[model samples]
Target: MTDHVDVLIIGAGLSGIGAAAHLTRELPRTSYVVLEAREVSGGTWDLFRYPGVRSDSDMFTMGYRFRPWRHEEALGSGERILEYLRDTAREYDVERRIRYSHRVIRVSWDSDTSLWTVEADHHGEAVTYTAGLVWSCRGYYDYERGHEPEFAGAEEFAGEIVHPQHWPDDLDWTGRDVVVIGSGATAVTLVPAMAEDAAHVTMLQRSPSYILSLPRRDPFAVRARRWLPAGLAHRVVRWKSILVTAVFYRLSRRRPETVRRMVRKQNVALLPEGYDVETHFTPRYDPWDQRMCFVPNADLFTSLRSGDAEVVTSTIERFDADGVVLTGGRHLHADVIVTATGLTLSPFGGIELEVDGEKVDPASLMTYRALMLGGVPNFVFTIGYTNASWTLKVGLVCEYLVRLLEHMGRHGYAVVEPRLPEGGMATRPLLDFGAGYVRRALDRLPKQGPRVPWVTSTAYGDDVRLLRRGPVADRHLVFTARAPRAPVAAEAAAGR
Candidate 1:
């Protein structure tokens, strides 16, 4: 059948829930609905069932701005994060608005009607939602599957092969000789957590990644939450985290060696004496070139020191019945092979978009302030900071969204879309990242022009100026009145 909403939000994850909650506060009169692909809320937190699937970014910054992260966990576990999200939804009364198992397939915008026709699949049946605006909160990842490279003789491997994205609920990893492939966040998290009971966990990686150890509970935050009021305490801790992360990112970019040494010193201090820290911990690229992994309380290093887990930097020639065979002819015995390779990046939730019967190529359009895509009318997507907590940017977008909506309602504007300034602007990759996953999916993602309003920066300050405090009506944006449609025969008859 058909349904309509003033605003239709896709993906009832962290971003979507936050968007709804923001609307409930800022624009209470606005009607909206959240369409979720899965039966549960909490997107990534719900999808990933892997061991040690805690947030890479600190919870203070990752958590929503309106809602205070009442816990002391700087990096919260996946389950804990889910619980926090559930509480947020309940507190804001957002649960009833979420329509689970509504996987949106496509959205087509109609300028004539100033509405978007959204096609979705619900339990193998067709469902449609016509909305004035579409807020894409679904993240830029392939939820259907993760990125896994083909390894020769994998079929012959005797052990259970697992990918963390689709971790089995009943997989018995304890007391097993587990070999996890890759040295990214997933690998680092899995190696230590599974090593707790695994016979011996080995992390096989082609190269090393820079990893940092952060406190599970920040003393300052704990004290602030106890002494200060809830709102004031949250703001204090959040800004503190934001400033620290920004400063570290700045130092990482400006003085690479200085930051590198600091990380090395910390790693050496935590690991056992003469543990070959250089060989296992040193990354060829500078810090933040690829996203750095963070472990709470040096847990990864503790596991390494206790000899529960080990790191092997080598390329796999192939996989044999027993385990992985390195190019150097070294065979590592493994009863369980966990491929913590990475995720596949998918833009616009891999949903097809059409504008006035023409297919819109998202990769061709430049991102408008990293929230809305140019030339796409009444559409916005949430893509968070690669360097800092994701929700930091989400909060700004939500604020800007309310401002834009209020502006539109006041002016009786039916449609709004960003237009590139005259004399075509130069463009670059939206994400100036060096990660393998980003590099692999660069061609599929969007681009950014080399100036304000077009470029998507990682800095929170830029977002404050451009999105939060900035003017809603700008030269690059086009505002138009609603088009009139002929009355239907049924409506005419009913009126008579």
Candidate 2:
């Protein structure tokens, strides 16, 4: 038996729930299904259990518009974020739409019927779904595992070696000499938390990453939020953060030298006297090339300043039984190792799509506004705010999607897809990548077209205007109404 849905949402994370809430409000009677790969629905927060996993962005803007962030601190741990998500899902009745442990494998578009046939592995068995449209809410980061480093004798190390992505619960860190590899957020966050409990924590990296220290509080802002209404406060903070992030991002983007100088000055002020600022704080790439690290508690700096954690700039040549051996012949002993390597980016549910007979390569397509894949339209994907809170961009994307869906329904259109003009298209990276999942997937993902509607804008204000105020035709959206099917006669059926 075949069951059809108006929209098939993949993943039940923050994006998926936001999409559902928006869609349900707009199309109350419309049926949509969310197929999740994992049994639980919190996505990143539910998956990553490493120590000190939390949001780097402030909670004021990070929290949903419908929800109030009651947290005292700006940065919240994984559990608090998870709880918020869980509560949101329940309140919105989004959990009921999710099918747990259903991993989608393929989506084939049937030209004749104009439907997507989704194939999936469900409960050790296969199942098929036919849907009019598909919404990909799966985040870019790989939840399965983080990237692993290949060090000689890595397997022979006696101490427990683990990646932060799949951190174990029972492992004790008391009196252990912990070594954390990599200089990304994962490594930066792990350093202070581990240093607090471990005998000594050493951060091993090939090169230093640009780190910025920001307070964990928005005192006056928080007070205003409490005194005033939620709507006014949220909007104010959201715009404020967006502007600050954009200014810094643009400075790093255009005036790299000035930004670098400022970064160096900050580093020198915070770092120990006679310590090489170039060695532990300077990054070769531009500030925003890779996501700049943010220290919420200022604990990372505190640890380094107090000599609780040693930051070493050297390559890991190999892993010995007791510890690590560096490329320059230096050796360090460690009782535990944490490989805080970055993540892999892929489409949600790992869904492979084919058109007619040819397989559709996502990398060849240009992403429009970093939302829709080049050729695919009528569907929306919520990737969330990378440099800021996940919910800020997600909420805006949801609002835009609801508007689009409403427009489609009013026009009696069954599908809407983006198509490039017959000639050809140009391509480039959506987000700059020196390292991490985003960089690794750059070649394997879609490219954006030139200019607005097709191009990506770093400005949140521009995005909001483009999404909310622009003319419908400006988006290159192709709308199609449902075609009437010819009726089959009883006599013809009998003959058959």
Candidate 3:
């Protein structure tokens, strides 16, 4: 049996739940359903169970605009984030609309019918659904596995090896020497958390990444909430956080050297006197080339100064029975090795798309306002800002989609697509991030044009003006109504 709805939302995570809530509030007449591949809600929060897992971005902007985050912490734990998502769903009454364990395999759009047919594996059986529009909020990471580099002689290691993406529960590290490989946010977080229980924790990295410390709880937010109403307080804190993030991003891009020096100075102040901050904290690349890792209250630095953790900057040649061997024949002994390497990026949740029996390659498509693809009709994917909190961009996208749908209904239109002109527009990589996961998937991901509305900007301020307040009936967006067809009986009789 096949089911049908006005809109089919994929992935019941942060984006999906927020999208549904927006629809319920803005387009109350529209019918929608959310399909989640996992057995439960909370997509990223539910998947990652590693120790010290928390949001790299502050919670003020990460939380939904409609729902004020009541918690005191800016960088909330994974468990708290999961609880927030669940509470949001419950508050909006969108939990009942979510169909869990529905892994969408394919989506086909037929122009004649002006509908999308989605096929998925639902609870060990095949299920089909049709909708007028398909909204994908499945995020950009491959949940099946993370990016793990092959280390020679890895099999010879007698100690247990672990990847943060698939961290095993009940695996005790008490009094064990732990070595975490990678200099990204995950490694920084794991180092401090593991050092508390482990005899010693070493962060082994090929190179350094820019790291900064932020307060776990914002005093300004706390004071505001205590003085003013909760709703007003939330708005104030959110905008303040957004402005601070935007200014920092702009400074990093405009004056790289100045920002670099400031970050390095901050790191030096955090570490012990005479410590080799240059070797362990100073990154070769310019600031914002890759996302800087943020630690709460200098936890990692405190641990390092206390002699509970160490940083090793070297290339690993092989993994021996006892530990990892460096290129210069130096060995780092460890009882447990954790590879906090990186993620494997997957666009549109790796679901295949077909339009009118023709396979559509996502890479060949151009991003339209960073929300919709150039040639795809009645479809929108939620991709957030890289420089700031993700929800900032996605929330705007959801609101814009609601306006687009309302406009289409008023105009009696059945399809809307962003059509690229056949002229001279230079194409570039969709994202400007230099992270390993993004770089590895650049060729497979979608392309962006050189100009506005076609390029995906990392600036949240620009996106707000373009996506939230911009006109829906833009010059490039082509809106068309499906031509009416004769009755089935009349056509059959005529053919006979």
Candidate 4:
């Protein structure tokens, strides 16, 4: 017999657990089941076991609004984050709802029944499930593989090459020279982390990414927790973080030069005097163009200043047996090479979607309020903001979805689909990020319209007003009542 639920949530990660918690607390009547492909509940936290793996965004905003983070640290380690997710799952009893090691492969929506049929591989067995609504909380990154760029003579390299996504547990490069490729968050994080044990760690990048220094621990959070209730204190800190980050983002866009100088000055203050801040720390683009890297307590700078780590901003010509040969003909020796390259973006967890026997192409669909897709009914996908903390937008998204569902139930609507006007709407790429991972998978992703409700803004304030407080009934959304089923006898006669 196929399992059935009112809502089928895919991926028991941060978003998934948060969504489930919301459903349990807000929509208590809704029956839901969470399907996680991995054995563990924490998705990204469990997958990435690299050294110094931590959240780039602060925990106050990144954390779920309902569950107040009691930790003193703003930047939490991967293990600590995993513990948080597990604790959340246990506290909300969401752990019981999650079916681990179940990878959903396909989801098909039936218009007549107004239900979705999901197929998944559960512990090497194919299992089927039906649900009134399908909620995809799976994040954008591909968990199976990271974005590994091809390097000439990479195979000729004698040393071990590793990717941060699948970091080897047994591998140790202590007292050895290491070279980390890529200038993204992973590279920056790895350099200082690995430098502590390794003799020397070199961050090899084609270009620099805007990096900022932040305190590992939040003094405000610590003080607030002592005086106020944990929940209230969390909210206070969260809002404060939101306001500051929002202002910074706005300033970066409005006054790029001013923000650039400020960021450069901050970096210079952390590093040794006369250090090549322009060459290594300075990015070609303005701040907020790409997501900025945050190094807690100026750890990366500390490592650099101590001569344990260094940065090399140049293109790689080829990988030699000893190390890498730069375009300028400089050869760096390395004992281990860590490919801290970017991630591969996969929408809807790379699951095949069909609507009434018609294969749905994600690229053909336009995003509706950045949650649901146009022409898709009874489905919602949670995607976080690129500019701000991920959970801030995701929390709003979950709240909005619950509101929409309640509205639909009261109206006796079986399906809700956003339909564009008769005239074609001008469309653009969904994400405005210039990151390599985003650019690599832009063609396969969904599109966004030029107008409101269709275009997704990274600004959390705008999203809160639109998604959290906006009306459920909109001009573009089309709701349909469920059609009556045929008689059993008639169906048998037709089959005979």
In candidate 3, which residue pairs clash? none
lDDT of 1 by residue, 184-276 (tens): 999999988998999999999898999999999999899998899988999999999999999999999999999999999999999999888
lDDT-better candidate, 3 vs 4: 3
Model 4: how large is the Cα RMSD against the reference? 4.2
lDDT of 3 at 243: 97
What is the Cα-based TM-score of model 2?
0.93
**Candidate with the larger TM-score of 1 and 2:** 1
User: Cα lDDT of all candidates, in order?
Assistant: 0.90, 0.77, 0.90, 0.89
Colliding pairs, model 4: none
If both were scored by lDDT, which would come out higher, candidate 2 or candidate 4? 4
List, residue by residue over 217-292, the lDDT tens digit for candidate 2.
7675687688878777767775676677778877888999999999788778877888888887888888777778
For every model shown, what is its TM-score relative to the native structure? 0.97, 0.93, 0.96, 0.96
lDDT by residue for model 4 (233-346), tens: 888999999999999999999999999999899999988999999899899898888999999999999999999999999999999899999998999999999998889998
Q: Positional deviation of 292 in candidate 2, in angstroms? A: 0.9
Error of 2 at 98 (Å): 1.2
Record all residue pairs in model 1 with backbone atoms less than 3 Å apart, i.e. clashing: none
Worst 10 residues of 4 by lDDT: 487-496
